[model samples]
Target: MASTRQIITDLRAQARALDGRHLSGSMMDGVCRSLRRGADELDRLLGELAMLRAFAEIPGDAE
Candidate 1:
């Protein structure tokens, strides 16, 4: 599994990659879909990260 920070870094790179590309209409649509998926994935990962941190903060949990 990837760390949340690395996934965010990759998403930023993908956003940067969208610049200066000569994409056809369909290709641009596909790229937009991919970016949307990435955004959704990032949201999920962030949620999981938050949950993990919350769980970790609880005292006296079994190891």
Candidate 2:
């Protein structure tokens, strides 16, 4: 499985590509929509990973 950091990085790159587009109309709209979805998913995944890491770091349990 890919790490959260790598997933976020890939999503950001996709967003950049969508933003750089010179097209107009439905195609551009579709790309932007896809980019937004990817970004939101990445954000959720990163948040979950952060919570898991925090739980793992708590003192007193297995290291």
Candidate 3:
């Protein structure tokens, strides 16, 4: 699986491409919106994964 940071980075790149001149204004708007949504979702997933990892490791922690 790609890391959350990697996913977000890729999404940003996609957004940049959408903003480039080849895309029409309306199409660029749609693509940027979709990419933003994807980035948000990826961030949520990463947070959840971090919580789960912490939960799983708590029992063995000595401090």
TM-score for each prediction? 0.51, 0.52, 0.68
Query: Which ten contiguous residues of candidate 2 have the minimum total lDDT?
Result: 54-63
**Top TM-score model:** 3
lDDT score at residue 57, model 1, on the 0-100 scale:
80
Model 2: per-residue lDDT, tens digit, 24-57? 4435656766867887887887677667878877
Whichever of 1 and 3 has more lDDT, that candidate is 3
Per-residue alpha-carbon lDDT of candidate 3 for residues 1-63, written as tens digits (9 for 90 to 100): 775688899998888777644543345777787898999888888777777778887532222
**Model 1 stretches astray by more than 4 angstroms:** 1-26, 58-63
Cα lDDT over the full model 2: 0.68
Off by over 4 Å in 3: 20-26, 58-63
Worst 10 residues of 3 by lDDT: 19-28
Pairs with steric clashes in candidate 2: none
Q: Please name the candidate that would achieve the greatest lDDT relative to the true structure.
A: 3
Query: What's the lDDT for all of these models?
Result: 0.65, 0.68, 0.74
In the order shown, what is each candidate's alpha-carbon RMSD? 5.1, 4.9, 5.2
Candidate 1, residue 6: the lDDT equals 72
The local lDDT score (0 to 100) that residue 28 gets in candidate 2 is 61
